[model samples]
Target: MKTGSTYLQFLAAAALAGQVVSAETIAQINGNKYLSPYNGKNVTNVNGLVTAKGPSGIWIRSTAPDSDERSSESVYVFDRNFGKNLTVGDVIQLNGTVTEYRSSKAYVYLTEIINPKLVQKISSGSAATPRVIGKDTLSPPNKAFSALDNGDVFGVPNNVSLISVSNPTLVPRNYGMDFWESLSGELVTVKSAHALTKPNNYGDTWVVGDWKVTGLNSRGGLTTVDKDANPEAIIIGSPLDGSKNPAITRVGDTLGDITGIVSYSFGYYTILPLTALNVVKAIEPRLPPPTTLISSGDCSGLTVGSYNVENLWAGSAHLVNISDHIVNYLRSPNLIFVQEIQDNNGETNDAVVTANLTLTTLTSAISSIGGPEYEFVEIDPVDDKDGGAPGGNIRQAYLYNPDILQLRKPNFGASTEANEVLPGPELKYNPGRIDPQNPAWTASRKPLVAEFETLDGKNSFFTINVHFGSKGGSSSIEGDARPPVNGGVEDRQEQMELTANFVADILAEDKNANIIVAGDFNEFAFVEPLENFLAISNLRDMDEAANIPQLERYTYLFDMNSQELDHMYISQALKPKAQYEHVHINTWVTLAEQISDHDPSVAKLNVCKK
Candidate 1:
């Protein structure tokens, strides 16, 4: 070991030779902005206590925390082999270069120390108590995600700017991202953690702590309303100690408490736990009873159901669960609007476009379960033309109980043919595709429209089943984009415009036409596309007409919010008698227990003339 004077002389000589030996405080390196101040600069003699260790690296927190809340006092040291011998509570001194790391352009950068030249354990057994996150200590902001975003994270015109390039100053008290950034790499404890979503495939789970939150729904999950996206929730990533997180987590399940290091990964701020988390209080299984709005078994009214079976085919294993959901949970409605019915080959891409075998399997399954022996109608799309799983050729179809209704003018339209409304206020071809060749519907599912008449032929109604373009390429709510890109919004908007025009033509011929449009729109009810559709068609959302609470109107759960992507709309003449209910067969269950990603909905309406 060299003497202090000798070491000083050596350091001086190294600096003179262009080797940097500058020392930096963790706070100074972190800075007050999104990016680090000392990034790409060599740092020496950085002292901190090893608060946590993981497979890839170790987290060190400064013993002398600064008064400024904008600067973090901790940072990750990226070196898998260097941290293998290190343990928590070991005070260590390291020399490295500060760097800002991100997995992709869509994610915010994480301030870290990389290319470590030296790591020396100065002492052992030093205790570093984690800061508890609660009412008194470091409560996360509940409403907004970023101050950079004006008010809503889901606003339109996304990808306008990136947070990393701007590197705005931190506002920890007002924004959730800033608050989490303030604690990056620091060990913190979350109390009374309730799961916001089920564990994903990698066993990562999102949870909300006991704090003030907005859009709290009846099921204890946060909801995405007009402006709030529940920014207080955080995801619990894989444990730092190389242990698996609980895989059977469900929304609203209590996790008791979790102690972990705050880090950024995969487009969201994550908390990598020091160890595995246990289910402290499991929520009771919410197996909703069958819908109460059953068919009246007459011509006065009809009960209709809408469900997205999630790319189902004749041989799909989920067929049983889906049939159970429709027969038992939805109470066997008079008509069912189903989307994502794959061709008979089930993603084989053999140029076969028919789904006859697929529908027969489902209708047979329903009858086997002691339900209605339904008749199905659909216009198959050109192979691989619709957007879905590449070979699936997914499309929408209608399943109607022949005992209650029949197609009035049963002329099935071809794949590329466009349906029209004639002078009789009737579909030119029953079970026809609407604007199938429109550019707005390029590589997307087309709308399936049909006119139905009661058995007595005294009452007639029309229905349109649509599965619009998906939000596939959308950015994350907490991503760098200000408003976050809602993928396929333009195409979906145009598709809605075309469909609304068709509805307009029908209403032009008959002002009091009884029409119901329902399916997996793959959009929020409050967003521009659906809102524009409702405005143009003069249709009322069934959820609103039925007086469903705003918080209870969700049919899907994603990220931190329970949202509605599936909807049912009725013309003004049918709104007064509409009654709706969302059967939570999928969303309320664990990921393993769910048959599909979306919940099904039922609506009862009077189709007969009043």
Candidate 2:
């Protein structure tokens, strides 16, 4: 055997022979910081109450806890060849060597006891009561991780620095992660918890305890606002009891009192419940009434709606519901920027590159509801070139009421043709692609620029429908990289700059050129991409022009934050007459019950002016 292995075996033998140094409690084993004090030592006669057990080992908690909040009172006893039956609540003493085992080099090391020599069950029937947490007990610090995050601020810079390397000291009461770290491995209870979002694929749901929270929405969720705090929330992970959680859960679904042991894994602080959670109250989501516009009755102004239908296909389950939302909830806007329209064959892997069925079915459904029978125009992308679901052939299309507006097709371009905004308030290829061959747009959706003339025959304005690079491939918020490297950030920045340059080209011809650029940019308003547009093009966000509440300006729900991945921007000429509202028919509802991932937004603008 190796010298190190032999020395460890010798120490084990000496420990079994009663030649032990001294008995230490579980608290002494778990020191305050990342490293344990007795990490590589052979200790014996440590006593604890068996609180939880698994196939490989059992977690034992000291009946008496140390006053130091930094040290945990519970420790895991690892057993390789397990044949013993140690039940919960059994007071036991074990002789083992303290060891820190890291699953991998990237993962954090767990302080535990390896190769337990002698486990003596001393007594049974001693109940270990859980500590109840609520307003009076342990309160969570409002916010997800720590202020020492990638950016000392949350949701700002992407992947500039790393938190693991910073290794900021644990501030339990100040940061949410540190708060949970302080109570690691201890049994606790959260009273009157509600689901913060839908249960994830693994049957885990983020929830908030019964206490005050920042950015509290009407549906009992914390909106992702710039200046809000939600410290009383946590994640209820998969039940350790092996029961499956419900496949779907909506926001505001009341989860009765939860009792679990605190633990950390896969980034977030998770609570491993001993038993499955039962839904005590399920809140039925309510859809808002159709948006009404108190505008010019002559239709000189148009209501434009933008929606990312999340790869919509003709026979998808949510097709009819999506149509209803477009007609009823969005009030049959004059111009609709429809994104993610799948081909005729849906996701079927074939050379079929048309979306006539998808668009026609939607228009026919609107006519059925007494809404306008809209005529659509679009350019199908080259087969498998656009990045999306394989064979989906998803592309952006414009659904306009031909009665109110006319497509300015002085010239039209093919699907692969590049559209450049030139002087004379014209497009080189009307309804054409924007810089398709640019490396920044490779495997990304190209913008569709179309010039529109109001039916009044007195006005013309330009609109660009763009679906920029998505936020996929981005690093996790709790990743090792500081600033949590947001993937595609560079691509998105380039895409926005290109789009802004196109807008600038229009302004170069007519300083008062009325321009409306709208669609799923797949970026938040405050990010660098949108910020770049503000700096270069001097555009105004419709959300700001309409005076929408800062916290409520979101159309998508991702992770624990209700954010905006869909947006609308107006040029200087069209800013004064802009009125916008995000119709919350989809994003605010349960995932299973919603029709689209993005909530469509309707904006009213006067195209006749300027």
Candidate 3:
């Protein structure tokens, strides 16, 4: 046939030109290692089948696979102007220099070839079969990231180091990051992938294919069981075919089979799909169960709630919605610890520290919703010293139903001064700030401790509401540090130590002191600071006391993981009969419906008995 004759003539013409045809393949250039040995060297007459193309270049796969798991059989050819002309399935020969591209400040390095000296379109319509995953291909390793991410522990001080400085050899099976790096630029297919995280503004999501996964919650996403909760998961990026991905996705949405090239971006291993993804099946979100018992201030017990209102000022929005959540979801507890209550003027920076308007507005909203007329008490912070929304003098406060538990008033102290815990029946002030003048309290919200007596006038309990220093100033999770520096961790530790010392002082006076420490500690329950608090006189986290599943205990969503930032730790005396309910009124819902970043939680403690 004429086609066969033409192919023979083409081969003859190539032999006469001495062009060194069929010299190398893409696999040779991409060895099973972090850095390429052929890097900075000129590669000549590399033949490949173009599987996909983008604005920057084309991803070419080896027509003759090397069949090596350690080496990638595909590579990216950088020829922006000429790449746009190439079509999928086109067999091409490229001559270029291989280079490792570091995307940004992140330490990940992507191996790619650039500045093609020759881009010969040998033939069109070549077969480009994507390597099907979850069928016969190798599954992702079950545990740890590469040595680069340091194994089993990423955020500990002992393992922190830079990959660039070490350039450690790749151990693809040991770590998720290294596994994806080994397959970089390779065209692969992930069959039946389920979304592990909700789509962000960019329509990017983390997903796991048909493979075994650890910490698989009932909702399908991985949770914090140990540390490496998401070993089989990878992020899916925007499609290169110029189509929008699906909207209204949740954690358990079935994102069907995804065929794409492996990539690294924004400190995560990613996949660039060839086409936009369509949801195969959607699972309705499982809402949290309502609190069992509503509080009516019976002498039998006291119910307490804690929440960060997210900068609630006098004229701020979401006032009604927040109050609604409190009344309906939180069940209108007897005493509620609230944080981020702004000054009367909101974020005006006018040096006014009082939040009478803000508190009154919220209380009025609660009463309007058929809830009790709760009275609030707080010691306002100095101008903007506490870190939060600028000019919004955010501080902690207590809102209690007068009919349930009355505040035991004590001699008030100056707002700037600290209120020491006296021996019995009285704090320096009834609802007063603790250690406000301590250097540890500088630029942070001081713990608000208050003494309350049951309406029956029998027993009294002390509660310390605190919002510790946030994780600002922490290094990037993908930075060179192994256990990335948790910014403001030391400050938060000192804050917890100071609060614990105050509780210790109270216990010294009364050995069986009924005390509760509750608020946004801004650290994980397993973190060192909280561990230090647990060692203090047997204070137990309500999560453990209430027997909530470790994977199901989360009050805030940050990055890819659901974490518990807001917590309530009860004294040893209250742990036996205490029942805590995490009202998931905010975190799992859509961002637009969120009144605050944190979900409010209620705990019923037998303060009267214990």
Best by TM-score: 1
Better of 1 and 2 by lDDT: 1
| For every candidate, C-alpha RMSD to the true structure in Å | 4.9, 4.6, 6.9
Q: How accurate is candidate 2 locally (lDDT)?
A: 0.75
TM-score of 1: 0.95
* Model 3 regions lying over 4 Å from their true place: 1-23, 148-155, 285-287, 475-479
Better of 2 and 3 by lDDT: 3
Q: lDDT tens digits, residues 1-610, model 1?
A: 0124554354445434444546557888898999987776778899899998877788899977788988889999876677878888998888877777776789889998766655678999999788888643567898888877788776666677789888989998889999999989989999888888888889898888878788888787888887678888899999877899988888888898899999988889999988887888877866766789989987665999999999999999999989988899998999999999999989897888899999999999999998999999899998888989988999999999999999996999999999999998888889898989899998899999999889888888999999999999988887888778899999999999899989988999998999999998988877888888988898888988999999888888888779999999889889876799999888888888999999999998888865
Best by lDDT: 1
Q: Which pairs clash in the backbone of model 1?
A: none
Q: Which lDDT value does model 3 have at 279?
A: 79
Two-way TM-score contest, 2 vs 3, winner: 3
lDDT of each structure?
A: 0.86, 0.75, 0.77
Minimum summed lDDT over a 10-residue window in model 2 is located at 101-110
Candidate 3 structure quality by residue, lDDT tens digits, 111-207: 7776565568899987777887645457787666656554544344533566656666667667665677778887889989988766778888878
